[model samples]
Target chain A: MKKRAVAYLFILPAALVLGIFMFYPLAYSFMISFTQWDLSATRTYVGLSNYRALIVSPDFWNSVLYTVYYVLGVLPVSLVIGLGLALLLRDSSMRGVGFFRTIYFMPVVTSPIAAAMGFSWIFHTQLGYANHLIDSFGGEPVNWLTNYNGIFQLLFDRFGVELPRVLQGPSVALTVIILLGIWQNIGYATVVYLAGLQGIPQTYYEAARIDGANWGKSFRRITLPLLSPTTLFLLVMFTILSFQVFGPVQVMTPQGGPLQTTSVIVFRLYQQAFAFYRFGYASAMAFLAFSMILIITLMQLKYIERRVHYD
Target chain B: MTKRHVTLAIKYAVLAAGAIIMLFPFYWALSTSFKELRDIYFEPYGMFPTNPTFSNYISVFSKAPFGRYLLNSLVVAAGTTFLQLVTACLSAYAFARMRFRGREIIFFLFLATMMIPQQILMIPQYLVVMRLGMGDTYQGLILPYAATAVSIFFLRQFFRTIPKDFEDAAIIDGCGPLRILRYVFIPLSKPALATISIFVFMWSWNNYFWPLLIVDSTEMRTIQLGLALFRTEGGIQWGEFMAGTVISTLPILILYFIAQKQFVKGITLTGMKG
Candidate 1:
């Protein structure tokens, strides 16, 4: 009885803090989602109207679409490149391996706002290094951030191809933000993949070599299968992270970029809640985004975990 | 050269190219920060600053309350980290060792909080803090993050791995539960404590959204919010902006360089478990 009482005493502080902050606020947020509050003295309960409006709102859908584009753009490219880097640097005994790892991981440690600032300077249209490089090569200076045209449309323009609006890819501005995401994420994925690579048994590789398997054959037969768990982990993590990307979008393209092409879900939520003082509407949007993330995570676990090879 | 040597050379070459690409942004930011406005705008810009000056760095401090921003960030981050450590240590000790009612269920509840996205909680949390009259206060900034599921979960796993013999010996010496935690578990789990400390400190330092929502005055702005707001207000002053970025990043970068192994291990530990 004394021990159990002590245990309760031990948990008291944490329980108080978590209960007051996380658990209570979560319930309060849910309750607020059902109301119309504008930071005023009173909140009038409206009963799902906020959610219904979000479901039919074009701006809400646009943010979701752009978020999906950002996720798709960042995830696969970073995974493949990260994996490749991991493979290249797998031999820890090799000279400069640590040096290379440190360089790659620097951006991961870098705050997103700082990274965005660096990228903004790099891609600045007139007075930027990117344009300087283009001018040096006798090419036209690309409007990297200001251009509202989707990258697909921009690419197809040279071929006299008019891509439909829906078929058009992420706007050039949003693509810049996506590029930043990929740049920061590649290092994290690389490090995680490196750890995964370390767990593979050397005997497995020796056996493959003895069986007359080449590098490509060994990679496909051994490496890919062995790294599936790591891949899934990275996939879930990157998806959750990419969906909530706001700092860079806000820093790089302040007003959600040209035509609001870069206004991701969190950015929209922030604007609704703070800028427009539509707390109820923003809470509804938050729940919707949260549900979407939950569903995707569950779906990934259910379907993707089946294929994950665990030793 | 032989095929083996050629392949080695190619490998090094590729790694070198990748390193250059990775380091270029930092290099550019550093390089631009030192340049005069004339040098920045001059046609046929030099790769490195021809006439490097400290004017931008000086102006960054002069033009805004950047020093105060750094202080605010330090206070909030340190305070939050200290509080998180205390709360996490206590709860994790209980979850790891003590026999209590509903222990498993409570542990699961703590784990469930990890999945609740901050976006969902931010609105009401803002309201709660404001209602409590902590708006724009350090406590408002620090207390909400005083307990995190990540730290508690992490410390619990570490504490579970500790040998039972230590606790038994401590108890034999007439140490109570609190004393055992302080004298035995904490002292023994120095590495684990350090890992969590660095992780929490870095997280608090880099946090932008919470501070943005809570901070209303120039005096309370963190380095992140200060830098961001500076970008908008000090439009097109790229030199000053880069200077601000370098200053804000320097502390974390210095910490990373000093504790590179801990940073990597912390990431792997949290990344794998969480």
Candidate 2:
């Protein structure tokens, strides 16, 4: 009875918070999505128009393609670098391990908006540091941000080849946003991976080594499998985060400009909601985006949960 | 022993390189903040300033009502953290040691809410906030913001792990739930509370979007919105922006440094899994 009392008391605030902020907003957003209500002007019910626009709109599809491309550009490399750092730091015998971990996690604590500004300045072609470095190497300062037509063209260029401009998925301005996203979040995923590394027992490593397993072999066969759960968690998180990305696009690609190639879905949603005050239209868009995220993340949740191995 | 040394050497070298790259951007942000405008741009990679000036910092405050913004943010952050911890503690204790009907279902339902993005709810939440007539008020800022599902849930989870006998003993001595919590659970849960409070404080301080929607007047602007005003202000003064970032980021950075041990421990313990 006493324990029951304590338990009820304990869950009360979190329950209240979840009820008011999260649960209410969720149900209310769904309701808002169904109605043509922007709240700034008079709201009216126009069921399914919002959902219909999702399938028909070219911009919506393009945003979807661009978001997927951005995820590819950032999330995979983020996992690799993060996992690499976690592996690198796991040897507790190493000196200054704590300090290294601290420095690595610092970026996670810093504001993304501020970091976006820094990256924007760094990537500026004319007077930017990147251009300065290129000049020092006797190379021409190529327009990194302006020249990319879309994703396909961008891929060809990376392979030191050229493609027709039509094949590209995202613009140069948007690519910078993607790269900066990876850089900022790699630290975060790395910290999470480091904690996950704690679950692995040292005896396994020693036994593997005694059996004449090389470092690469141990990492591939043992570490990789063990770290799958963490990787899955990170993948789901990154996918959701990718879909809702706004800040970098806001700062770096102000109108998601350079031919609207950088304009992501969330940025578009913000423009419609706040800037245009087309709350009803924006609400429709918001809900559509929300639904897409929900479906995708739900799929991910199912996929990852099955593979998750608890040690 | 020799193999161990080799592995350790490799670990240090790789970790050191990654750490340097990770920290370089922040170092540059701080260095540029102190730099004279000409040096920052003309020699972009220059790690040190030829001439440092406090003028940028002065301009950040003088050109805008930054002091007011900082105070506004501090009040909101402090108030939210205070209330969140109190409510979270009460609720956490209820879930931890208390026998309750529908405990598992209610708790799981609450946890399920965490998986959804807050963006989905923006319009409706805004409408609710507007309807409440709490716009531009501290009560508006503090009350709505205090619904910290993460903290309360985390606290509740922590409370469950603790042995129930301490509370039982205290109760047998005629202590009430609140008193038992005051003398017993509070002491043991200090680390968890500190961790939760710091994050809640940081979240409240750095939150821009929701506040931007609700906070109508310039005076009510938190530091984040105040800093973002640079986005629309006089020149897109990159120098001033760096300066402003440096100034605003310092207090939190300093606090984080002081509390880093607890912060890291908290994250490692609560953030890794359930």
Best by DockQ: 1
In candidate 1, which residue ranges exceed 4 Å CA deviation?
B272-274
lDDT (Cα, tens digit) per residue for candidate 2, span A149-178:
665675587788776543565676677788
* Per-model i-RMS: 2.1, 3.5
Error of 2 at A252 (Å): 1.8
lDDT of 1 by residue, B203-258 (tens): 88989999999999999999999999999994448888989999999999999999
Residue-wise C-alpha lDDT for candidate 1, range A1-311, written one tens digit per residue? 89899999888888888888899999999999999999888989999999999999999999999999999999999999999999999998899999999989888888899999999999999888888888889999999999889999988999999998767999999999999998888888999999999999999999999999999999999999999999999999999988999999999999999999999999999999999999999999999988999999999989999999997
* TM-score, structure 1 vs. true: 0.98
Q: TM-score for all predictions?
A: 0.98, 0.91
> What are the Cα lDDT values of the candidates?
0.91, 0.74
